[model samples]
Target chain A: MTKLTHRRLSPHILNRLIEGAPDESLALTDDHRRSLTARFRAVASNDHRRLDAWMVERAGLPYEPFRWSPASARRVVGNAALRRSLSEPTLTRGDAVALEVSDQLLRATSGYARPGSLASWLAQSSPSVVGLVSAEAANWATQLDEAAQELERPWSVAPSDAYYDVARARTTLRGRRDLIVPRGLTRVVLRVRAGAPGKSAGPGLRADLTIDALAEPTGLAASRVIGLWPEAGVVLSVDGTMEDLRAGARDLVRTAVAWQRHRLARAA
Target chain B: MTSLLDTTPVSVMDVLRGERDARPIANTTAASGLRAELEDGIFALLGPARRDAPLAIRASTLRSGTYAEDLTASLLAQVRGLLVTQALRLLSVGLEIDHAFDDALLAWRADVGSNELTRFVDQLESDERARLATDVTAHCVTLKRSLGPLSSRWLPRTSLRAYQRLAGGDVVLRDVIDLMVGTTTSDQASVALLDVTTSPLGEGAERVMRYHALVQTLRTSIVPLRTSMFSTAAGELWSANVDDELLSRAVGDVLETLRVMTVAP
Candidate 1:
């Protein structure tokens, strides 16, 4: 019995095993391949089964182990039969290629798969077993090997400038804005001086002025009807001198303002 | 005693805003009386000081028309605003403390896992684990409930305007009490040590310490004064010529008493 060379299976078959394929049909013809491609396109758009069948048929190889259903193909591709047929040199070379493809897939998908698993499966077969793998596959494998080596190099000596440029390109999409509110209450102060210094001694001598009037003048002069509350009431004692009294009134106004501001700020 | 004209008016706004420091000014009977009068005017005019105040001052006119009416309304409005603000402030404090205690209690229960003890007993045919779980769960529930009403009853019920006008406006004395009682950090070490020797009591001994801290903080914040005063009780109390310093002092005294009781060694 002729030993089936593992190299007979194409890279298209490897791609089919990794990417997955559609249902198997009995009739192995161009029309059958077309129908399978249509069915796979309905599901995933990229028909791995159609590609694999075309490669195998064009290479004029009998579909023996490769003709199984897609799920069974996944199992067989990873089996020991394929692993023994490939020489160590061929397996190692195939692994180098598979490693590149896996690395590319990972970079594209953001660390979604293990590199070792893909490399192990690809190393089980040779290019000759897979029959004339595409030039695109060979080129991708070489580029992937270079990328893997670049990644494996020491971070300290690695091309950090290139990485930084890539990172900068990613983050240049957007920025942010900030808003600030002013603090505390708005305030105004008024200083009052008695017209006649001694006239300060009498009760109800001057009427109470509204706060706004205190700030600015109005048409009507101050009214006795609006007499200050303290002026209307009788006093009990005279402990301090007139100057002291003026100073005390000033302090009280100051205290009121301070207290008002503190209260307002606390609320805010 | 002298009339308002006898005493010179100094603006309190500068002092309050920290623009000017308070001086040791003498308070003669006349000056004190004048000061009191000025305070009333200041309070009444607080609203007009706002940027969009309608009480426009005319440079030529000595009197502003409708100033008196506007001033009265403004004063009432200011008092109402103060009441509502204070009530909300107290409520917020109470809610925060209550939530903290609730969280601590939940953490304590989960840490012990007395709930799983019952399941262990059921599987083993021995009643020991079941009994322990039941006992621990009961103790935890008791401690949790001791924290008191999570929701405060002291929030203002009346309109904000009315609350400001009412004497002893919507301030709830109990809200302060709740805050003091709730925020107090119990002597955790002492409680744990005691629990080692004996089963933890429904109210751990450390609760008293927490109560003390709360009352002390509350008392320190309020200033004391000597006469009858108007204050927000729950936020609606407003009155003319009310002694605010006296009211603050009274609240302080009440908190002090509670602190003394809680801290009694």
Candidate 2:
């Protein structure tokens, strides 16, 4: 048998070699796209189901319900006002926008304690989390108020925070949908960013879109995903094709695997 | 306009609310002409820079100013929030919303990601944090005292960002307004723009205000009612009725700067 020699090139060298290559030459065929999507869907469904079963039935890992803040300090706050705008009548003034979010936040967090004393409760829950929700809420209110001046009203429906449970499992997924708008005969998931526009779909956002797509209610899946950067006044849209769904599924599986490993590692 | 630097802190709210007199922009044709001429020259100079680096004049680049400006601008947002939302507490069980700077600071920190200001705060020790908070508190107090309790009627710290394509889309002119009041109209000037700064009133102050007013005029085609400068550090306020003179001078100054920056050897 002839000995085989394999060369491992540095990533920098590999990237340099591929730099400025014709995109058409590197494009995937339709069959390749379909096959990749099918493989990803199988991994999410079949492989995920098998592993989850083993963790529960064989290893006897205790079920922990996933809990997520409806208004995390990160990206969620920017969406608060957009979500509110979709549900309420058009708000033309910043003050009105601020008032709207303040009411919604009060109602949303009413379950925690009372409306005005949320900081104390948040402090009790976690001191680091204080004022995070409020700041984001305020920023979103101001942003949407400005945006409303430019955007035409109508065409959006059923904007809300969503919670989904995996099929026959204790695991839960929480996500924010700024708006669900009809695209031709199908629906599209919309997210609005406050600052400059971004075209690249990062892994985290792709996972988020994937999870939201999978959690569609009653045979309805988002046919497209849109990200609107209002400051830059740019809209980025991606078709909800199988290829996109598979990309999302792939990210979701990677996340699930990492989460399981973290849980098991902590347990041991 | 008479100087009001007397026993009382000057009230910018009245000007923002359009209680003060405003003169129509003088020589609108001349001012507009100068602006166009200078902008074309600037784009011509910036063309080489664009070829070298396409993104040298983006929105973020437009905001690249002194560190003090960025920090003070952020701090002003918090102060504005407190003033506007003083009446209704989002999660307040009590009638009064919490006025602690510490809470507001924490919230601002949470929402802002890793930026220059955040990195600065991250490296600060407790003493440094306290010192920075104290200085911010002083500025806020002075701003509140100067502006008086802003009626929930007015919007505070309103942000404006727009891009005007110039040089046949080869060059983009980015405009940013710090805070604005009054509803803008297309046919006429209705809005009042207030430029907030941490630095004391300086030579560049009036020029900056003119630039801001000019940008708004271009954006809306209606002259801004008035342009004002509010310095939180010195507790001073200056207002000028937007006219063709200030706008023309601003255009000249911008053209000079561009000529020096890009065209000069």
Candidate 3:
């Protein structure tokens, strides 16, 4: 950790995570990853047929990959904008952050989002509309990230979002980490959400921890996962532990099973 | 670009930021305390808000929306205000406003997301649309004149949303700040909110400002340094520091708004 001369009793969330959070990786060994992987695979294998059926249907149908346009996709673009704002200068300048995010959306969604998609709306929209889209997308992240702008650098590094392909299953369990702070080999992941976090937030954090941990081949999972609901003004942080990973795996499997069963039943 | 008001000794922003002489500004802790109080007060008097149909409170819901009951003029005023706000955001972000109305309209439609609202807006007759466009351009000019080019140091954020579910999901308070400047550091409170409007300042306008302050406090624990509302139509700006008295008024306003919603059929 980069040491500061003096730290307050209760610093802001950024300071707490960067300066005070423990290294969760310290507790994990190769043995833990192997066990966690095996545990998930064992359960997932039981419902392989159902899982494959769901994956097949998922790819067969058309769907829009969520991305920001000038005016839509607040969460998707907001997180990215926040990370970019943390490192870049002059972001607070007229619509700079939003405009950059707009360009990013166009690049990310090209040939992916359907032609009539909102992500494609910016290309045909007027200058003011484009400005509006950029502003809306950048505003939430700016509000959250700018609050801690004075903190030292590298705290708001772009989070490495992961997609863990389920072992022996056709589905990818996606995990989102908004911001990450490094502490030696171990790291802490922060997720900035839009509104009041609900009861599902706990299971959501567990799932995030499990997916992020397993995505890495050799590295340990982040020491902590923080869920921030900017609208609600709340932060929830969960330590990465074996027990937490176990719960995360179980919830992921249970949720997949229930969802697959519902989808198959609907198709029938 | 220099502001139209640059000729004046003190600009509008200077006036808004001028009240720093007050000691002990509002911080996130006080805001948190108010949240708990507001939540407790709701359950104590009004009972819990029903999960199925909670009051989604907005600024327009104030004064029982008596003036906005399908009045075409009021609707035009609302749209005009939105366009002007959009114009300011666009200009702030470095977009040229050659056709202010059309540019803002495109962004506004995308943000609105309601098919009904967009459909109504898109279906306007050519003459009405032209007139509306002219009015919006004029308002945008006023906004540009008043706000000027805000320096990046202030960390200007546009259309900042304030949404919080209070009373354990019974009452949902939502508002939008046209422009927000400054933010809290680890030590001090520095956030300020500006609500841009088409109408002149009145009792209703002040109520909306108080409402914005309260919702913003709950949304971001950092109490704002000051909250101001500028009427693009009148070129008038009303600003006040966030203090215990203002927050107290906000809490009362929220409970009272919820109470009215609870009793209404």
Candidate 4:
């Protein structure tokens, strides 16, 4: 009798499992990480299609390119606020941090050469519309400030958003780390979300950590990933491992598939 | 207080737009008297209640806290934010299509907190969530239909909040303007304020616009040119040129509200 190998679960499939079992905590053991990594590698090798090709061809998705600044503002704002607060040791109150973050965002707008430069956009546009953008920025900064207050450790490296590009896959990933404080040999990646952890939050954090992990060179992985929902005064922590990357890759595939299905439905 | 000059009053929008037609307010005496009356009424309540603590009031609290009223306000604000952001993107970079209602909503939820609206939905059972989602979807459609065309021309500065103290900081009045357009000046009205509401047009809605104008007037010596209120539910707009009379009327209403609040409490 011929030996049979079971089909490896895709990121989407794993995500469904994660979503179904919300009560199950995601504490991946080292052995589990290795097994997951092997499964991820096997799946990637067997699947000859590149991400870009799958997105464009299989999904039939038109490349609706978006500016990075607005989509990634939540992550960027938190990190920037923390960096500014840390720079000025006297600044303690979240409100003060909130104001600083607001200023940073407003200042950064001047350098925005992107198609949707908020400053330039507001300058020509009606003054009333500027309020929406400013209010949005203010709210985000406030939340970040609250998150910053909750974070006890002093950050060694200044917080910033990062971009990772893989030439072979033609994939670009953006990672926003609220604070990156080094503890011994491992760097902790903290993410500040607005409210309490929802159903998708666990997988979402894993996906975020995966991007951060892949963005770094091999062997220098993030030791821990912490998701902070400041409004709820809650902290969710997960180990950063190769399993996260595998899960993230599966999520990417799932996202493409969902996009394809949506496109096809619309076309029909 | 500056005395009224015997001159023709300009429309508030024109002053805000910085048009040459901008002029001083028409009836400063009546306006001042009305304001004084309101202040007296407020002090009547505040003076006896608690001398040690300053009264704190939010502009939102002035309105009825009915579910419908709260829901409408929140919905209008959300729609305004969504439209403004889309308009910014369209004007600056130009997208092939602005985000659909669902996409815009997702973006809105991301930017805003898990607010009352989210909480309202979350507390509901599965069946209730389905029904509420359907109702909300329909409401969203109506709002989009009303707001889509208006979004491009608005070019507003949204969520402008201000506080004013009367009677030596014992009485504090707060107001938040949903949207402000054009420029503001000390000598001439140079800005137009737009207050968006989800509720149908009513006296309360009008008073809210007046409160916003009053706040702006206190902040900038020159009264704003036009104060307009838009109702998303009815898709109707009512705009009045800002004069001392309008600001004074708003002051009176606020005072009356305070009188009721402080005394009733």
Please report, in order, the local distance difference test score of every candidate based on alpha carbons. 0.23, 0.47, 0.66, 0.49
Taking all chains together, each candidate's TM-score versus the true structure is 0.15, 0.56, 0.79, 0.41
TM-score of chain B of each: 0.18, 0.70, 0.86, 0.65
- Pitting candidate 2 against candidate 4, the one with the higher TM-score is 2
Residue by residue across A86-201, what tens digits does model 1's lDDT show? Answer: 32434533343334444434543565435444333233323221211111233222222221222221211111101000111111101000011111121111111111112232
Query: A1-268 in candidate 2: lDDT tens per residue?
Result: 1111111111122122122112221122445434434543443332333222113212324355433331443244445444555456464333343454355446546564453343233434322233335434444554444433433323442345455455433344444456564544455555555444322334334444545654554423465555544444444444455555556545444545555666667769
Candidate 2 interface RMSD (Å): 12.2
Candidate 1: stretches off by over 4 Å: A1-180, A183-268, B1-129, B140-150, B153-265
- Model 1 C-alpha lDDT versus the unseen true structure: 0.23
TM-scores of chain A across the candidates, in order, are 0.14, 0.52, 0.71, 0.59
- After TM-score superposition, the amount by which residue A106's alpha carbon in candidate 1 deviates from its true location, in angstroms, is 37
True contacts kept of 2: 0.09
Q: Give the lDDT of residue B146 in candidate 3.
A: 75
Best-fitting candidate, measured by DockQ?
3
Q: Rank the candidates by DockQ, best first.
A: 3, 2, 4, 1
Winner on lDDT between 1 and 3 is: 3
Interface RMSD of each: 39.7, 12.2, 3.5, 17.5
Q: Point out where model 4 deviates above 4 Å.
A: A1-268, B1-39, B48-54, B59-62, B65-104, B115-117, B125-155
